[model samples]
Structure formats: structure tokens, C-alpha cells
Target: MTETLQSLALSIIELATFIFVFIFLAAIVWLIWAYISDIRQKKQAIRRNFPVIGRFRYFFEHLGEFFRQYFFAMDREELPFNRADRSWVYRSAKNVDNTVAFGSTRNISAAGEILFLNCPFPTLEADAVPPSAITFGEGQARQPYTTSSFFNISGMSYGAISKPAVQALSQGAAKAGIWMNTGEGGLSPFHLEGGADIVFQIGTAKYGVRDDQGQLSESRLRSVAAHEAVKMFEIKLSQGAKPGKGGILPAAKVTQEIADIRGIPVGHASISPNGHPEIKSVDDLLNMVHRVREITGKPTGFKFVLGAYGFLETMLKSIHERGLEFAPDFITIDSADGGTGAAPQSLIDYVGLPIKESLPLVVDKLIEYGLRDRIKVICSGKLITPASVAWALCTGADAIVSARGFMFSLGCIQALQCNKNTCPTGITTHDPDLQNGLDPTNKAERVAQYAQKMVHEVGVIAHSCGVREPRELRRYHAHIVGDNSFSTSLELLFPTRSVKPEYDKRK
Candidate 1:
């Protein structure tokens, strides 16, 4: 028995040695093959020189992008939106304590930094009145619209975002008492599912209410208006993302459902015309607005980014000649740096005036022409934060609309995959697996929280400015960093129009 046990141990040791030798020889052969392949490959010099070690460099570099964002980037370092900006939105949406301890982490020395001038005796919360409801298209429009919320959802199409995203926004808007603008892609079933006040958008393409020839279809317009949820119509001239350009939907993203809604062919590039073929001048635009409002019995407006001030001057002058009643109910001045699903790098980077500049410019012009009461100015660019919304109010914007902020509420990580169909958060993508991860019902609550928080905080800013309400906040309430490295009051820079209206005093 002792001899048999010894033999068993010896046999086990021998088998182990044999396996080790086999693995050693296989590894050596594989290394030799890799070395030869790397040396022969001329495409990569580092791989040729360092063999396997060089591969790790690329691996580490690939990981650095995420690492930088999560670990290395300071709160205010990132562009477009920094870590602090996104975190605020996330916390607000989750209804968490968003107040930061210690002082602000903002770089006040930075150019273009905005500062609010608080009154010594701020308005007490109890005495401050809430934002009052403002009516649009009052006398001219057969069915004018009214809403009190200053912050609202901007244009984001059902196709650009997902079905679940649209459903969530619609329900969230209804709960938050704000309106939702159905982007230029056209109205879809999800838009009306939540019984929310809807603003139907008419792109240059004429989309949902278009005939086979792409002309405005009175029948389709009437049908969409028939729904009690649809409240107003917006004629989109040019969005901020791509000025002098048109909306673009890649062939791959053109699902049959979206195509049907937009009256385009499936599996085809869904590109809108640069400008409406029928709109040769400002008169043509007014005519179109009148036609839509007449058919739908609703207030109608046009959205555009500010370009040549001369044209705006001409348009306003023309409106004056045509009568103030001919003016659009509202004008949406989109920021040049506005976000979009897809656009040429040239346009997205440097083609239009940002909201910071455009908002005041448009407002000043409207007030200059004495058309401020006739036309409401809805500013839509990057007015995401409470301070930003307050800034809009102080700078004379009647309403604020935000798209990216609401997207964040729906769990978007700014993956920048919106133009593609691989959005992992399920906010922008249509893939079944991704869509399953996003719960519309759960996200809807988050959306409502974000909107309500914005309303509340903006009111806080207005009260701090010693205003009775948000609309009362004026240019004197804010300051902009000047080129001379000093904070200059906006009232001094973009001073009140020489011919001020009596209402300005009350504000």
C-alpha cells in the first residue's frame, strides 16, 4: 500500500510537469508570432517597436476620456456644460437638497460671467406675487393662448428623442403646468397622449399638416387642431443649431413610424428644405401665420435665430405698416450655440447669435418698435438653470424654453450619440434594448420636478431683486462682465429704449 501511494504521487507530479511544459512552449510560440506580426506591420510605429506593451497605451488612453470626466475634471472645467451644471440639473430632477455648502465654485473672474444685483431690502416671500398669466395673440388671434409659467419645454421632435422620452415630456409638462413645443419634425401620437397643452410646430417642410406636395394641408391642420390638447401653432423659420440650413434626419434613423408622422418615405434621408418655397419675403411669412391661425382658430408665431439686424428692422417696419395686429403672436429667438441632434460642424460651432446676445437684441428691437405688447418674446437657447431663467426675465424675455435641460431630466448623459441611434440612456435612441431601460412613468416625475424647481428658484431670484414678481425683474437687476474687466450694469449697457413705455416704470 505504501509503494502504491508513492507511485500515485510520482505520477501526479509527472503529469503536472508535462502540462506546465506544454503551456510554456505554447506561450513562447504565440509571442514569437506576435513579434513578427508587429514588426511587419508598417501602420503603427509604436506597436512595431514595443510589441504588446504598446497596446496597453491605447487601452489606457481610451479609458482616460471617461476617467477625466468622472475623476479629473474640476466642477467648472468642462465646456458646453460643466460637471457642476449637470450635477445641479441631476440633483434638482431627483428632488434632492441641491444647495451647495461653502461658497460657490464658479470662476467669477471669467469673461461674460453674470451677476445678479440683489436689492438691500429684498421683497419678502409673503409679499411677492407669483408670475401672472400672460396672454398671446390677444386681439388678432381668434383663440389666444395663456400660461403663467415662465420656463417651458422647447422644440424636440419625437424622432429626435425616443417615444418614451416624448411620453415622459408630455406627461411631465401636463403635471408642471407648462406647454410643450412639438419640434419641427411634426406632431405624433405621443404628443397628445398625456393631455398636455401642445404647440404644434410647422417647419419649413410643413410636416404633419402637409400634402403630398409638401404644401400646408388645411384639412390636416384642422384635424390636429380638433384635439383639445393642441393649443397653438409655431411656424419655424430657422432654429439656432443650423441657421440658413434645414432639419436633417439620417436615413438610418428614419423609422417607419416617424416617417409616417412627418409624411416622409421610410428608409430615406429626411431633409427639410432650407427655406419654405412659398416664403419669398416677410409678407409671405405673415400671410402663412395668418392662414394657419385662421384655420386652427389658435395663436400662431414664427421662430427664428437673429442674423442681419437690418432684416429684422425691415420686418418690424413692414409689420408696422401692415398694422400691429398683423404681427406674430410670439417670436422664439434661439441661441446660435443651441444644441441639435445633427448639424454641420460649421453651423453648430459658429453661425448664429447666442441667446445671451440675441435675446436682448430681439427684445430691445420689439420694445423699440412699440410692439412689445403685441408680440411675446420666448427665448430658447441654454436657459437651463434658475439663474439663467432669471437672467432671461431680467433681460426682458417674456418666456423661456429649454430642451437640453429637460433631456437631462430624462436621464441623458450627453453621450453626444443623439445623432446616432446608439444612445445608451434610452432618451434619444429607438433600440428596443435601450428603450427598455428608460421608464417613462418614472422619468415623467423627474421632469415635473425639474420644471417646478426652475419656477420656484426663478421666483427666488426675482424676490431677491425686490420685485413683486418675475416679470418685474428688470435690466437693473443684473450685470454683465465687461471687456475692461469690470461688472457693468445691463441697464447702462443695453439701456432702456429712449422712448420708454409707461409700463416699464411699473416693472
Candidate 2:
């Protein structure tokens, strides 16, 4: 019996030894193959130089972003959006208590920092009223738009974001009683599904409203305007991210549905013209605006990023030469740091004016021209937080819009994969498997919560400033920090312009 037990143990030991030997041999073979492959590969210099050991560099590089976000980044240190900002949005979207425990981590004395002036006698909660409704194209268009929503969803094309993301935004916009810009991709059925007010954007390519030859089609324009949900039309002269460039959709993301909606060929990279081919001069822009408003009977406006201030003066002077009726219904000024799906590094970083300088410039120019009352100023570009929104109102923006804020509400991780088709959160990708992570019904609720929270918080700021509503906030109600570690009133920095006597008389 002792001999039999000893023999059984030896057999088991032999089997374990054989298995270990097999695995070691397989691993050695794999290492040799990898070493040869890395040495022979001409693509990567590190891999070719260091052979097998260099393969770890790519793996480490891929994992570095995650590590930094989770471990190394301070609350207020990240660019585009810091951890604190994203955390606030996440909490707001979840409809949880967003109140911070301790002191703010923000650098209050930093240059360009905006601080709201609190009044000794703040407005009582009962006295505070909702933002008054603002009318667009009041005597200019047959069907003018009037809405009380000052905070709105900005231009995010259906092709740039996933279908579920669009659906969620639309649904959320409706619930929050705000308008949704259909971006430059054109109006898809998904845009109409949530029953929200829509602003159809006309890109330089004239995508949805283009004819077979890629020219503006009056018939298509009429058809798009025929929808009751489409409240306005915005001619996108240039966006902030790539001021001199155009929209770019990767071929991989250009599915049949998106292609059909955008009036482009399927599986082809959709690149818009750098600028409107037909609308060359400022006169041509006004002409196009007049034609669109005439055909659609809806308010029409043009969006652009400010660069050369001289062109604006020229355009306003020409507006006076022509009739006031020829002027655009509204003007959307975008900031330089605006986000986009794709853009070249040079244009995205170096071109255009930031919203800090541009918003006040445009607003003062409008007031100077005596067109402030006629042209509603809607500003966008990183005005995601309540404080930023309040600052815009204080700086004279009639309304504010945000795109990345809504994307965050839809669960974007800022993975920087927007130009690629592999967005981890499914907000910007077309992959069905990735999109399955996003449920429109659920994210729609989050979207609504985020919008509602933003509006509510902005109201809180307004009340603190002793204003009855957000729109009542004036430039004097906020202060901007200067380089000398001192703060100056926004009113002093960008003083309100007095209207020219002749233009004021016309008004």
C-alpha cells in the first residue's frame, strides 16, 4: 500500500513538470518571434531599435492617459476641462447633491478669472422671476421665434455624434424647454424625434439643402422650413475650432443614413468647403440671409468666429446703407477654444479670438451700430458652468449655448477619440457595440437634469447680484482679474458704447 501511494505522487509530480516545461518552451518561442518582428518592422523607430523590450513603450503610452486622469491630474489642472468642472457636470447630470464640502480649488486671483459682484441686499427667492422671453426677428420674419430659455444646446451634428447622443440631446432639450441646434450635418429624423425646437444650420457645403450639383436648393430649403419643429436657420460662416477650415467626417463614420441625411456619398470622408462658395463678400452673406428668411419665413442668422474687427465695421456700415430689414435676425459669436470633432492643430490652437475678448467686442460693436436691439447676440465656446454662463450674460450675450457640456452629460470621458471611431463612452462613435452603452431614455433624463441645474444655478448667481433674472445681469455685475493681481469691472474693461447719433436716430 505504501509503495502504491508513493508511485501515485511521483506520477502527479511528473505531469506538473511536463506542463511547466511546455509553457516555458511556448513562451520562449513567442519571445523569439516578437524579437524578430520588432527588429524587422520599419514603422516604429523605438521598436526597431530596442526589439522586444520596446513593445512595452506602446502599451505604457496607451495606458498613460488613463493613469494621468485618474491619479496625477489635480482638480483644477487639466486643460479643455479640469477634473473639478467635469465632476460638477457629472454630479449635476446625476441630479445628486453637487455642493462641495470644503473651499474651492480654483485660482481666484488668476488673470482672466471672472468674479461676480454680490450685492448687500440680494434678491429674495420669492422676488426672483424666470428669465423673460426674448424675441428674434420681431417684425422681420413671418414666424419669429420667442423663447424664455437663455441656456441652450449648441451645434453638434448628427454625424459627429452617435444617433443615441442626438436622441438624448433632443429629448433633454424638449424636457428642459430649450432649443437644440441641428448643427451643419442637416436635419435627420432623429433630430425631430424628441419634439424639441430645432435650429437648422446651413454649412458652407449647403449639405441638406443642396441640390445634386451641391448648390443651395430652394425646394430643399422650403421642405426643411416646412417642419414646425425647425424654429430658425443659422448660416455657419465659420466655427471657432477651425476658423478657416470646414467640417470633416471620417469615412468610417459616414454610414448610409448619415450620408443620405448629409447628401454625401456613403463610406466617403465628408469634407465641407472652407467657405461658402457663393457667399464671398459681406454683401453676399446678407443677401443669402435675406433669401433664406424670405423663403423659410423663419428667423435667419449667421455664425462666425471673430478675427478681423475691420470686416465687422464694414458689414455694419453696409447694413446701414441697405435697409434695416436686410440685416440678419441674430449673430452667433463663437470663441477660439471651442471644441470640435476634428480639426488641424494649427487652426484649432492659433486661429481666432477667445470668447473673453470676442463676446464683449461683438456686443459693443452691435450697440455702437445701434443694432444691439435688432440683432440678438448668442455666444458659445466653453461657457459650460453656471459662473461662465452668468459672466456671458453680464458681458451682454442675450443667450448662451454649449456642445461639450451636453456631451459630458451624455457620458463622454474626454478620451480625445472624437476624431476616431472608438469613443469609449459611445457619445461620439458609430460603433453599435459602443453605442449600446448609451441608452437615450436614460441619458435624456441626465441631459434634462444638467440643463435644469445650469439654469437654476445661473439664477442663483443672478439673485446674488441683486438681479431679478439672469438676462438682467449687466457688465458691471462682474469683475475680471487683471495681470496686476487686481480686479476691474467688466464694464470698465469693455465699456458700453454709445450709439452713433445718426444710427441712434434711425433706431
Candidate 3:
């Protein structure tokens, strides 16, 4: 019995030793293979120079993003949205106390930074009469949209965002009494599922309403407008992310359902024309708007990013030649610094004008032509915070919209993987496994809370400016810090009336 036990123990020891030796040999082989591969690689000089050890550079570089965001990057130091901006949105969405005890981390003297001038004797809460709701297409549409909420969701396409995200936005917007713009992707049942006010976007491709030959299909237009939820139609000429460029939906994202909604074939890269083939001249543009309105009987407007106002001046001149009644119901101006599902770096970086410059320009032009009352100016571009929204109200935006702020409310961490299919938070990805993480019912409340809080705070700013309502804010109420490191009232800088903008009163 003792001899048998000894033999068994020896066999077990030998097997363990063999396994260890094999593992060691395999590790050496992998190391040698990696070293050779790195040295042979020509794309990265560091990898070629230092072999396997240099591979650590990329690993560390990737990890550095998380490290910086969590530990090193200051509150005001990140791009697109700093930690401070994101944190505020998170807190507000969570409906937690978002007040700060310490002084602001903002660099007060940043060039062209806007500062609101508070009134000596502000309007009391008791005396404040809330701003009246602005109505669009009053005489133009069978159904006009009248909403008092100043801050609302901007255009984010159905395919660009996940099902849960749309569900949340829809329900949330409904709860907040705000509207949701259905980016050029077209209307989905989910968009109407939440029963929120819907703004159906008509892209350059004319996605939902296109015929077999890709022309405007009246039957499809009527079908979409038949829904009581769809309140308006916006003809998207260009977006801030890619002004002259078109929308690109990679082949992977065009699932059968999305293809059905967008009226495109499944599993193909859906590319919209760079410019609407039907829209060549200013007359053609208005004609398209008129056709959509006549067909859908809804407020029809066009969205675009401003480059130079030559085209705008021509359009206005044509409108005067036609009539004020011929003017489109509204104009949705997207700032150059806008968000998108996917955009070229060149266009995203340098193509369009930001809202600060473009919003005032479009508003001033409309005012110059005396069409301000006829066309509601809906401004979009990073106007997420109370101060930013208030600034737009003062500058002349009839309403403000934001995609990223609502994205944050939906628990987006700015993963920047929106174009990719692997968004960790599930807000932007179509992956079912990822979508499971977001509970639309719970997130919807957060969305509503964020919108309500934003409107309330803007009202606070209006009262501080000695105005009864947010719409009463004007250029004199806000000041911008200039290059000389001194503050100048926006009334002087982008003076609303100081410089006479050329206007051809054709009447």
C-alpha cells in the first residue's frame, strides 16, 4: 500500500511539472512573436523602435483618458462639455440638490464670456407673470404648435439613438410639456409612443416621405401628419455638424426596423445627397416648404447652419417679392458646434458658424426684414445651461434646444462612441444587450426634471434682469468680455440696432 501511494504521488508531481513547463514555453513564444510583430510594424515609430515595451505606451494612453476625467481634469477643463457642466446636468437630472457652496470655477475673464447684469430691484416672484407661449404656423397650418417651455430636445435621429433613449425622450418631453425634434431619421412608432409633441424632420434625403424615385411622396407625408403627436415638419437643409455635407448612416446601423422607418434598404450605408436635388434656387426652397405645408397641414420650416448671409439676403428678397405670408413658419438654426451621430472631422471642426454668431445674425436679419413676427427662430447649439438659454432668450431666440444636455440627463457619459455600436451607457447604441441597461421609465423622469429645472432657472435669470418673463430679456441685460480683458454690453458688441444691417424693403 505504501509503494502504491508513492507511485501515485510521483505521477501527480510529474503532471504538474509538465503543465508549468508548457506554460512557460508558451509565454516565451508569445513574447517573441509580439516583439517581432512590433518591430516589423511601420505605422508606429515608437513600436518599431522599442518593440513590446513600447506597446505599453498605447495602453497607458488609453487608460489616461479615464484617469484624467476622474482624478486630474479640473471641473472647467474638458472639451465639448467640461466636468463642471456634466456634473451639473447629472445632479439636475437626478433631481438632487445641485447648488454649490464654493465660488464658481469658471474663468470669469474668458474672451467673449457673457455676464448677465442683475437688476437693482428685481421682479418679485409674486408679481412675475410667466412668459406667454409662442405659437408657430398660426395662420399657416391646420394645427399650430404653442408651447411655453423654452428649453426642449433637439433633433436626434431614431437610428442614431437607441430605442430606450427615444422612449425616454418622448415620455420625458411629454411630461415636461416640451417638444422633441425627430432628427432626419424619420418618425418611428416609438417617437409617438410617448405621446409627446413631435417635430418631424425632413432631411435632404426626405427619408420618411420619399417615393420610389426619391421624390416627395404626398401619401407618406399625409400618413405621418395624420398622427396627432407630430406637430411640425422641419426641412433640414444642413446641420451644424456638417453644414455642406450630408448625413452618413453606416451599413451596420441600418437594421431592418430602421430601414423600414427611413424608407431605405436594410444593411446599406444610407447617404443623403449633399444638397437637395430639388432645391436649387431660393424660389425652389420656398416652394418645397409650401408643398410640405400644403400636404401635411402642419408648420413647415427649414433648419440650417449659417455660413455667409448672401443666400439669406437673397431668400429674404425673394420672400418680399412674393409676400410676408409666403415666408416659412419658422427657421431652426443649428450652431457650428453642434452634435451629430457621425460627421467628418473637417466639417465638424471648421464648416459652420456657432450659435453665438449665427443666432444673432439670423434673428437680426429676420428683424431687419420685419419678418420677425412671422418666423419663429429656434436656436440650437450648446444652449444647455440656464445661463446659456437665458442668453439666447436675451439675444432673440424664440426657443432653445439641446441634444447633449438631454443625453446627459439620460445618463450619457460622453463616451464619444456614438458613431460606434458599443456605447457603454446604451443611450446611443442599438445593441440589445447595451440597451438593457437603460430603463426608459426611470430615465424619463430625469429628463422631465432637467427640462423643468432649466426653464425655472432661466426664469430666475429673467427676474434678476428685472424682466417679468424670460422672453423679455434683451442684449442690454448681458455683457461679453472682450480681448482687452474688459466687459462690454452685447448691445454694444453685437449691437442689435447700433449698426444698420442692409435691408431691401421691396414693398
TM-score of each: 0.89, 0.95, 0.93
TM-score of 2: 0.95
Residue-wise C-alpha lDDT for candidate 1, range 1-507, written one tens digit per residue: 999999999999999999999999999998888888888899998989999777678999867867887889899997567889889899989999989898999977677888999989999978989789999889987778888988889999888889999999999999999999999888898998887899999998888989999999999999989888888899998998899888987787789999999999998888999899998888998888888888989989999988776787778778867876668899989999886588898998989888888888888888877778888999888778988888888898989999999999998887777888898999888887899998989999999999998888888888888888888989999998877668988898897674335324244
Give candidate 1's root-mean-square deviation (CA, Å).
4.9
- Tens digits of per-residue lDDT, candidate 2, 1-507, equal 999999999999999999999999999999999999999989999999999899999999999988888899999888788889988899999999999867889999999898999999999999999999999999999999999999999999998999999999999999999999999999999999999999999999898999999999999999999999999999999998899898998999999999999899999999999999999898999999999999999999999999988889988988989987889999999999996589998988999999999999999999998989899999999988999999999999999999999999988888989999999999889999999999999999999999999999999999999999999999999999999879999989999999998888554
Model 3 TM-score, 2 decimals? 0.93
Which one wins on TM-score? 2
What is the alpha-carbon lDDT for the whole of candidate 2? 0.93
Which of the numbered candidates is closest to the native, going by highest lDDT?
2
| Each prediction's whole-model lDDT (CA) | 0.87, 0.93, 0.89
lDDT of 1 at 264: 92
- Write the number of the candidate with greater lDDT, choosing between 1 and 2: 2
lDDT for 279 (candidate 3): 93
